[model samples]
Target: MITKEKILENISKIRVNKKITQKSIAEFLEIEQGSYSLLERGERDLTIDRLLQIAIFFKMDIVDIITYPNKGSYNKENEEDIKAILQIELKKDKKDQVMKLIFGDNSLEILNN
Candidate 1:
């Protein structure tokens, strides 16, 4: 079963990897830093909306955050499948916007060329 502790651990790892500070995240969430710290330490319960916001801030799926520190091997195929589904679900303009943000204007140029 997924635990709050596991989710927080994943959030911490992702934050560190991305060089994002707790204060920055707190600012984004419009919450007090202490409250954010409490959430990170598992001292406070996280709401689903808050979790979703965190996932969006990290540019990750909520499932990835909740399923962190997986015991088994990573499932690349499943991840790819999910990505494919998301791409199909998103509208063309929105998809292009997301792709530009994730990649860059140069990526769009490459695609067009």
Candidate 2:
């Protein structure tokens, strides 16, 4: 069973691996730094949307995030496979929509480059 503590531990590991700070994540999520600290410490409850946002920000699948063991490492191959699958599954229009949602008006530039 997945526990909040496990998720928090995974998030902290991922963040550290990515060389990101809690303050950066908090700013991205538009939440207070103290609130974000509580989240990392497993003292605060996370909403589904917030969880999704964090997963997206980290370029990870929600399932992977939830199931990842605290001491385990990230699977780069799996992440690449997921990206390829997304590229294949998302139709041009749908991809555009998703890119717009993720990158706003810079989606085209980001996709093109």
Candidate 3:
């Protein structure tokens, strides 16, 4: 189950890892930084459209944004760990897409397996 809280938390990790500020995301979303902060803090309910917009801004699939690890156990710096999580969580086609997005040319062998 993809809970809103998990989605927010995953995106927050991505944002922090990428060194992107709330103000940058706020500007991208055309909303106030305070509003973005509220959303990140889970005080505000985010719409699916807004979430998709954020995913687009990050050049990531919405599933990748929302598919969090079990009990929130994950290493933000480990791409292989994230890929394994995504592989477990995603269906075949979506997994293929995510693999391509993450590893580009190197995903071929993984996708075949």
Which candidate comes out best when scored by lDDT?
1
Query: TM-score for model 1?
Result: 0.60
Give the runs in model 2 whose Cα sits over 4 Å from its true position. Answer: 69-113
- What is the TM-score (0 to 1) of candidate 2? 0.58
Once fitted onto the true fold, the runs of candidate 3 whose alpha carbons sit more than 4 angstroms away are 68-113
lDDT of 2 at 77: 53
**Model 1: per-residue Cα lDDT over 1-113, one tens digit each:** 66778888989998998999999999999999999999999898988999999999998778877876452345666775664334256888987887788778776876777
How do the candidates rank by TM-score, highest first? 1, 3, 2
Question: What lDDT tens digits, residue by residue, belong to model 2 across residues 33-107?
Answer: 899999889788887898899998898887777876432356655775664333347888998898899899999
Ranking under lDDT, best-scoring first? 1, 2, 3
lDDT of 1 at 77: 61
Error of 3 at 8 (Å): 0.5
lDDT of each model, Cα atoms only?
A: 0.84, 0.83, 0.83
Native-referenced Cα lDDT, model 1: 0.84
Assess candidate 3 and give its lDDT: 0.83
Model 1 residue 31 distance off true place after TM-score fit, in angstroms? 0.6
- TM-score of each predicted structure versus truth: 0.60, 0.58, 0.59
**Lowest-sum lDDT 10-residue window in model 3:** 68-77
